[model samples]
Target: MEQVLVEEYRNETLECLHRGHICGVGPDGQVKYEVGDADFVAFLRSAGKPFQAIPGVRAGIKEAYELTDQEIAIMTASHRGESFHLETLSHLMDHTGLEQSNLVCAESYPMHRGSREQIIRNQGHEQRVYHNCSGKHFGVLSYCKLMGYPLEGYEDPGHPVQQEIVETLSMMAELPADQIARGTDGCGLPVFALPLKHIARAYLKLSCPELIEDEKTREAVQKITAAMHAHPEMVSGTNRICTTLMEDTNIIAKGGFKGIYGFSLRQEQLGFAFKIVDGSDEEWAHIVVSILEQIGYANQQTIHRIRERFPSAIRNDAGKIVGHTKEVFHL
Candidate 1:
């Protein structure tokens, strides 16, 4: 069920007033518990990053082509467009003798407030690296270079890269392409369309591809997971939610804009995907932590720690501190 409520309360400590929208995925992995349709069609967004990074590893390009851990990390990232991320992107392009003109993504601002001012003051223009999906674009370039696929139409749905990704996801999820919610990601490549449950299944399958019938799919999953774990930082940045989520809890998690998150734990072999129907991303930490708890990876103590580390929005007004969200479900 999906739940959204308008509740009035006061924050006794901070003394502020505010409104709240709370949405979550509990330990049981229900798509929609309280409100409904939590399993509604979901895009998976950059959460699909690892899937896009697979071809490189499955083909043994990582071993024979000597791809660095850094490159592998970048391949699975939704970076902050920091100086370091941009530098790496440029270097990756240099390896292929290409430049900015080749990117298919629309230009945008930095995801990290950390680099916004410096970018403006120095460059007089927002750089493409700030688009957050630049590393993904660079990954496409790397694939094109490796497979000798024509670069001009690689971003189009009919291209070989898109076809491979679709085929891979189709076989892995045991679903047909038409059933998947295929769409153009913000970064200018075809992204699989799926409901939250299927999205979670995709991640879990990555964690345990032996469950999949295809041997190549199993190897692809293993390679991508190892590469991501080896270079966690490039998946996000210094303290990004995805990067920290991966490093701290040792879970494979990625966040998408407009409130979507997915993760899978290979040992127990479970999966989870959730979305806030009303489209709220501010409560990302709460959603993720609660999901982890539901999966048995965290207890009350861990929940308390995560909450303290990332406080919910509460404000104190005339009488009480107001809670910022009302996602009816709890961990």
Candidate 2:
């Protein structure tokens, strides 16, 4: 139960430190590697998007709408709101006869810097579809439409869509529905809280859908994961860690708000998750790279690619090398 020092920021000296927990579990729910308390409880945040999208996929939304792999990827995405992301979302809404007005997520600018700058140059206002979580909201609304459920209170925990989300998560996590704690997410939807291990367990099933009992759920999981792998750009965007990592490897990775990251190794059938105590998203990539290297899931070349793309090097105004962040943890 030892807490590990996950990252360190150094200038002329060590300027900051981040401590967190990392847990790796096999398919059987046995802890294969641990840095700190694997049982630490936290909200899954956007890391739960894939599971949340399960209900829609299981309800035949994909087949009914003739959704493409790119569309399915966005349904489980925390996209950066680039033009392509916006276009894909618009296509989905158009197909369903829904509009941006139906989205429960608040209006926000794109997370992609270039896209944001372009929108600003055009004097464009923030829109609900530009929100990073809009695709997830769309998934919920699509589920409501497919199931003939009411759309007004789809965000409510008592809503059928929310209940189905909870049930799907419980089934995947192998935990009872009542034991999962509930809270509101950043996007105005219910987010579930459970132990880190259970989250890992859910990712395990995501990585290997053949383990699922229900044929429909299993197929949905397979389709979603395949879509994520095939179109990582739709899942996030250019230069995003989740997108880059999934693009370069066979694994499926997702990062949630508040410094939580989860991934499942397809070859090894292993699920891994971690959380930074201080919730510093900047430190996530370094920690994940370290974990993959430590566990031998990724080779040195892949690690080098990630570091090159998502460098933790700190620089000054002149672009001089001022400092850098280093991973300090090991399995």
Candidate 3:
């Protein structure tokens, strides 16, 4: 069952509420705290990018392409198509010899406000290269090229690259491949569905790769997380939750298209996954801040930064105070 996690107040009266499930797993891989149905199953969405890029990393794409940390980090990004993101994508393509035609993600303009407006002012058209998932697609295509796999119909679930991605995610989540549900993503790639608890476990694995028994997988996880931490901006963009949370080196975090998010606290040895029942992302900051506060997170500065970037106070068109969002759940 869904529980109200956040409430929006207008003129001191409750105007709306956000209901969701949150699952937090301790170092032992057991659910330590939860609200609502911790067992709720949902699609991982872009939250699965880190694991999706693992196969490419394990295949030595970094070494083969001499890719920088920014390039590698972007592979796991839901970039906002800022200028920096476009530059990094170009660099990644140049290094790997990947063309825009190789990407199967839908055409779109930049997701960033200023960038989109700039494009519109110049009468620019939508482009596949500007799609947020283009980096993820590029990583897969790079893997296919290196492995001698066919690029045609690469989005098909039966493709070897896609199969490898599923297998990699299974290993990371500590769940059998057969037990994990699957569907196509908005970007034409397969999306994974798993319980919230397993999602936390997967993020925990990313944070503490030492817990992994397989050396190759462990190494890949380390590189991916490190890249994310080293270049947080490449992971998302300015003021984005993923970028903000990852700015704290101790935290490895990512969010999906819907209201889904996952993160791990390295020092605390805890992982958390949460989703808004209505698929709204508006309350993400409030929920995340509440979770950190409830958990007694060590880095107060990171929490402060998140609040500053995603303020709870609402403002009207003339900048007058209107309403505020409040976290209503504990743990």
Candidate 4:
């Protein structure tokens, strides 16, 4: 394996390095490009939400709850917990006959700075509903309600909802269910561990769901991908890399905890997944842009927008430019 320095951070006169592995796969499950150890195993974290939501969508939760595309997008989100996000979650819970109390995720303040400040100014305490993973938990609850399964332990590996999620992920990844490892997420849901290539394969299926043989799975993937693209804001937020990337190009992207980022290119039917070994979110946006450029998917306009919106330049207290972050990877 070759050394892949994904990003470099410079401050005045010193540089810090971030290294990682990246893998790109086509619809046929063939590795199209790779850097470093493409087989490196890691937890998917929230990057798996879109796939995890497949079972619920296939179970008719979308039709039953009359979920809008924006709402469906939130279901697959690691949102910024903006006011709009909370309102959307509230509406989804209302349709499902659930309440904030029903959510199993731990309480947390909003991830968006403005939302957090507003809540504090209003003397409103943090609630489970404001947690970034609340939408995902709500989707799990909806699945439990639709199937009449016990919602109390829905996050348990033995639970039917979790079992179905695993099965759905397995089908999409073209891997055996038993081969997929499991772990607990920050939101107390079951997260998956697999090779980078398998994760890329899942995203490839998401981009080209028509390639799936099962009618229900295909329909679910199509709906989820459409929702993410149509309402990118619900997937992340106004200033997030995921939202900006999807909005600017024909790619559906998502970022997860521990520096996991994945995206699928709709026009090319390709999927990419990568991990920053140091788990630094700061390098993620830069690496994503670099990967898109390397794969020949980003246009000049898209590159300009990304640079304008996600500048990695270091600035002094007076906002003077001191140094910058740059991509160092060849592919």
Candidate 5:
């Protein structure tokens, strides 16, 4: 528990922290942890993005909105807020008849410390549109326009866009609307809060969409999964782990709003979900690295490349990791 807390409680304080979060599902389709109720509910934040985009995909606006697969992949993303990030998001906005100034997301800087500085030096101001969730916000706008739903209050849980999202997610988890808790997302939209098990179930369902009786939903899932694998780099960005791993492999990979991470291992017909005890975006390396190791994706060269892309730092006497963050993940 203390080890997990180490990632969650990075900011030192006097209080003893008792709270923690979740990890992957066991073979039995239940989460394997004890810190929180394995079945307790919480918001998926951006983690629910891909699932939310399902309705839009089903409505047939991918190319009509001029969306690429990578755009579609991170449309469900909490992106890194870099230049390509800005381009894709801005393009999505223009495609939907919204202005760059219309975005309401609270400003978020790049998760990559290096990239954040570079972006700021180039732009000369803080930018909310460049925030990773911007693509998602643009997506909501597109969904509203394409579906003829009011863009006003579209982010509200009661709005048609969110309603479609809820229905799709609820159906995927085999739960009803009331069984899911709805909350506002970082992007100012209603996000679903479900049990970790159900979140895992959603990924499993994505990998195994044949279980979905809805033909349109099932077909859309297939298309999104195919596109994610086909254009992994676009889904994430250059040198990003999600982009690298998903592009190189057959998994349907996506990172969620906060610290939630999920993927569907297509060949194995399995899926995984983990919510970092803290919503630290950097902790993604720890969780995903640990998962790759557990799932036998242990190629030395592959792991080496992956680690270099998002190296974890463990400090020594001076709190420096020699040159990199030492990967430490225990399943």
Candidate 6:
């Protein structure tokens, strides 16, 4: 069952409410807090990028291509194709000798308004590298190049590269490989579906890798998380929640399409996954703030940043404050 996690008010009367499920898990893989159906199954979408990049890291793609942390960060990013994102991606391809054509993700203009407008002004065409998932594809392709695997069917579930990723996600989620439901992502990559609690567990392992028994997996997690920390902007563009939360250096987070989001706190030793039943992401910041407040998160600076960027005050087309949003859930 879903709970009313946020409510929007216009002229002091409730105008809209968002129902969602939130599940927080501890390092011990036990539920710490929950507000709705903890067992609700949802697709991980791009929220699986970090875990999907694990196989590449394990294959030593970083060393093989002499990739920097910024380059590595892009492999786990849903970047908006801002100028800096393009620059970093160019560097990554140059270093690895990867062609934009190698990425199977469909070509599209930059997701950032300013960047897309700039390209339109110049009459530039869409390119595959501009797709948000291109980095993940490049990471897989790089791994395939290193491992002597065929690149033609790399996106297929039965492909060797994808096989490794499945094993990695299964190990990280602490679930058997066959137990995870599978689906094709918008970018044409295989995506994982699991209960919210297991998704939280996977993020918990991501933030607190010491709990992982396997040494190699721990190292890969460390490298990936550290890359995300060192280059939060590469993980997502400016004003994105993922970059904002990770900028605090204590929170590890990523949001996916269709209102799916996952985050972890190192100090709290907790991981959380939330899904908005209506599939709206507009109130994500409000819900995140409410969660932090309920959990007594100690990072005032991080909370303040989020509130500053995404205040409760709602605005109209002319920027007039006309409404407000408030948290409705207790946990």
Estimate the TM-score of every prediction. 0.82, 0.96, 0.98, 0.96, 0.80, 0.98
* C-alpha positional error of residue 59 in candidate 2 after TM-score superposition, expressed in Å: 1.1
lDDT for each residue of candidate 4 in 176-235, tens digit (9 for 90 to 100): 999999899999999999989999998888877777999989998889888988888999
Which segments of candidate 4 are over 4 A away from where they belong?
7-12
Superposed model 1: Cα runs more than 4 Å off: 5-35, 298-305, 313-327
Give lDDT tens digits, candidate 2, residues 72-180.
8998899998989999998998877778898889999999899999999999999999999999888889889988999899999999889989999999988899999
Tell me how far the alpha carbon of residue 253 in candidate 4 is from the true structure, in angstroms, after superposition.
Answer: 1.0
The best-first sequence of candidates by lDDT reads: 3, 6, 2, 4, 5, 1
lDDT of each: 0.66, 0.86, 0.92, 0.85, 0.67, 0.91
Candidate 4 vs candidate 6: the lDDT winner is 6
lDDT of 2 at 167: 97
Name the weakest run of 10 consecutive residues (lDDT summed) in model 3. Answer: 281-290
Indicate the TM-score of model 1: 0.82
Off by over 4 Å in 3: none
Q: Write the per-residue lDDT of candidate 5 for residues 78-109, one digit (tens) a residue.
A: 67775666666666666667765656777767
Sorted by TM-score (best first), the order is 3, 6, 2, 4, 1, 5
TM-score of 4: 0.96
lDDT of model 6 at position 5: 91
- Residue 53 C-alpha lDDT in model 4: 87
Task: Please say which candidate is ahead in TM-score: 2 or 3.
Answer: 3
RMSD of 5: 4.4
Cα error, residue 68 of model 1, in Å, equals 1.5
Runs of candidate 2 with Cα error greater than 4 angstroms are none
Q: Which of the predicted structures, 1 or 2, would earn the higher lDDT when compared with the native?
A: 2
Against the correct fold, how does model 6 do in TM-score?
Answer: 0.98
